[model samples]
Target chain A: MSVLVYTENWNGKFKKLSFELASYASRLAEMLNMDPIAVSIGQVDRDELEKLAGYGIKKMIAIENDALKQFDTQTYTKVIADIASRESAKLLVLANNNAGKSLAPRLSVRLKAAVASGVGQLPEKLSPFVIKKRVFSGNALAGLELRTETKIITLAQNSFDLIEKPADMVIEKAEADLAGIAPKTSIKDVQIQTGKLLLSDAEIVVSGGRGMKSPDNWGPIEELAGLLNGATACSRPVSDEGWRPHEEHTGQTGKIIAPNLYFAIGISGATQHLAGISASKYIVAINNDKDAPIFEAAQYGIVGDATKVLPKLVEALRKAKSA
Target chain B: MNILVCISQVPDTTTKVKFTDNNTRLDTTGIQWVINPWDELSLTRALELKDDASSGVAKVSVALVGPVSTEPTIRKALAIGADDAYRVDTEALDAYQVAAQLAEVVKAGSFDIILCGIESSDYNGSNVGGMLAEFLNYPSVSGISNLDVKDGQVQVSREIDGGKEMIALPTPFVGIVQKGIAKEPRIAAMRGIMMARKKPIQIVESAPVEPLSQTLAFEPPQPRPACNFIDPDNPEQLITLLQNEAKVI
Candidate 1:
């Protein structure tokens, strides 16, 4: 039996997430005393595939097909299930991102493998296979047990560190027969957001809430984010009131992010909002209310009017960068 | 055309989560139940489609896998203009079990369009819609932000890695929706609330499907250190602390 990891690529290039999955799978393979194998679908360069070797992935399978160019959950699940069965994979690991979330459940059904989504930690026990994951939107943690012969897990992003253990890797080409299979859905158009750091991929995030007072008062938030080379986000009410785009909303109902540094300006943190950013390494909150819930979760806080404090902080940051 | 929206009852967002029974179960004391926020938005979108005559949407129904205690939350969905509801008589143990149960409901009542929230706020499992589609052998679209149906054709815009992708699919598909499916969830009107009392809630026996995973225990997140308050009068000091102390900037 082998441990299999699915490495996802975008535009024929792998991201840091793929390396993280490889690192996770290598450690898991060690625990189970099994070989670690990675499967990369779509088009990726051979040199790029060699990068997995640094994370201890020795065997890699590449499946290139015109029909598999676009991501279809159903088709991808079928392909991965075939690989898992052929390799006799006892455990399958995937990143808990958009594509992974869409594919894991279907694969679970196809393989009849018990799935534990958003797992944050490695398993401490293998007899009954128990792991921990965030629950109640990060308000709490739940310990879960997988009671099946085969197991599948989706690792939460940024939860595991990428540890390099160099190894000699071999690439294998596999062809999937798609004669009678076809996707029921087709992509009519794709609009990729360009020239901006995506919130999910950012290390620092500057966010605001209703306390910013008006949509017109967003200049400081943008300026601060630009100076820090970070992304900008907002609370749900800010998006609901049209102060910011819905895509910028961060909460339990919206995007969940875990940046290295998060600035919550003029935002009184609600539980739902806190849930989204709880994974952040360090949180800094600025609010007029000293008792705002955001302060409780933040590592550093400034209790004053954001309108008075924001511009001054921006100027200070500008000067510091130049110094 | 017929539409079905799956709903789940969750603790109010403001309610503080607490565990009982040696951290094995959620404490229900003093807790207020409400419809999952994402499910509410999905139901709102379904009703909006039914409200339009040109869309040819004739009925909007809801389904839930819960016990009798969840009826109040199910009634709230009907009050918000769902024509009727189906309640599977059992507590949802896991995502697979819940999806299996919901598949039976969908098989019994033929629905052209099915809507499910991306994930429940309580468990944040994010598995049901895709698993349910697999159970019924139907196509499913995840991360749906906008959905429109015209002339019996279903089109949805889903959020991908950096942007959105517009997809066109036929009938009998599942849409796992997040925010932006509707501008905002609609509030129940007085007349709608009064009429909802007469609507029927069909209770089906739970299917004998075993759960794939089990929850061992629950615990609160580790508490953060106390906040170090920087003097607001000296705004530059905060930047210095961030640079020299926090080292984030």
Candidate 2:
């Protein structure tokens, strides 16, 4: 028996989450004293798949099919369940990302395995298989127990570290019977966001809230982020008000980010907004109200209007860089 | 065209979360409940579609997987312009069971489209919509920001890893909606509130199923560290602190 990890890739390249899954699965395999196997779908460069070798993956299984170019939840779930059954995997791991969140529950239903999503930490106990996850929108943590023969866990995004434990990996290609696989959905077109740093890759993030007043006031915020080479984000209200794009929203109901440094301008730090950003290593807030809830969570606070403060801060950073 | 929006009641975002019953149950001593913000957006969009003369939407209904204690929440959804509401009387059902129950409701009704929040505020599982789609054998699209329907086909814009994708599906599909689906959540005016009191909230018995996962215990988050205030006049000092102390720049 082996532990299987479903490595997710996009555009013929593996995402950061693939390494994290491989790293965490390797650790889980060591605990269970079994070989860790990585399985992927669609077409990706074999050389790119080899990168998982450093994360303790002993075998990489690639199942390529022309029909599998795009991600289909039903097709992927059926294929994964078939492979897991064949290998007799006791534990399955995935990243709690957009794809994982949509696939895990359906996989559980098909495989009859107990599934847990948004798991924030390693399993607390092996025998009972208890995992800790954020609940109540990050206001509290819940310890969950899954009593099943096979357990599926989706790791929260940016929760674990990727350590290099190099291994000589063996790559295998399996020819599977993918007949009669009809997906209900079809892609009509795709438009990619261009010329901006992805939020997941940025070390620093510059964010604003409704305190910015209107969409017209976003010039300084964007300029500040441009100077720092950081991604731009906003609170839920800002997105709801149409002041910014929805993808830039970071909060409990939005994207969860774990940047090393986060700059909050004109934000009050509501519990929902704080839930998405609590993972940031350090937070700096620029709000006029000293008693704003953001100050309680921020490491550094500047009680001033962002309209006046952001321009000066940008200027200072520019001068520092040039000097 | 019949539209059904799945909504859940959650503790207000500002509530001080607490647990009781050996940390297995949420404390409800003084907690205030509201329609989950994500679902509020979905409901608003549903109402907008119903109001559009050319959208072909005939009625808007809401579904909830909760006990009778959530009737007030259902009434609030009706006040926000949903024509009817259905509640499955149950508590603490897992994601799988919740989806199954919702699938049963969908099967009982003639719905052309289904919508739900990307995930709930409490559990944040982000599973029910897709799972429901699987059970009903309907196409499911999660993280959809915009949706347009014409001639029994829907064209949607979905947020992906680093970009966006547009997909088209036939009628009777499930959409997990996010912020871009609606600009603002509609508020219940006095007339709508009065009308909601007379609206029907149909209570249905839930079919029981074993939960695959169970909550064992709970723990509050660690207290945040103290903050250090800086004068706004010295912007240069802020840069120095970020470079030397934070080491992030």
Please report the candidate that would top lDDT against the real structure. 1
Top candidate when judged by DockQ against the true structure: 1
Tens-digit per-residue lDDT, A1-323, candidate 1 = 89999999888898877888999999999999999999999999999999999999979999999999888888888899999999999999998877888888898888888899888778968988988889999999998999988899998876788899998988999997676779888999988865356676577899999889999999999999889888899999999999998878888877777777899998999888998888887899999999999999999999999888888888888888898
List model 2 lDDT by residue over A45-71, tens digit each: 988999999899999989998777777
DockQ, in order, for the candidates? 0.67, 0.61
Q: How is the predicted docking of candidate 1 categorized under the CAPRI scheme?
A: medium
The A-chain TM-scores of all the candidates are: 0.91, 0.89
Model 1 segments beyond 4 Å from truth?
A197-203, A226-229, A315-323, B228-249
- Model 2 segments more than 4 A misplaced: A197-204, A210-217, A227-229, A240-242, A252-260, A300-304, A315-323, B228-249
The candidate maximizing TM-score is: 1
Least lDDT summed over 10 consecutive residues: which range in candidate 2 chain A?
A193-202
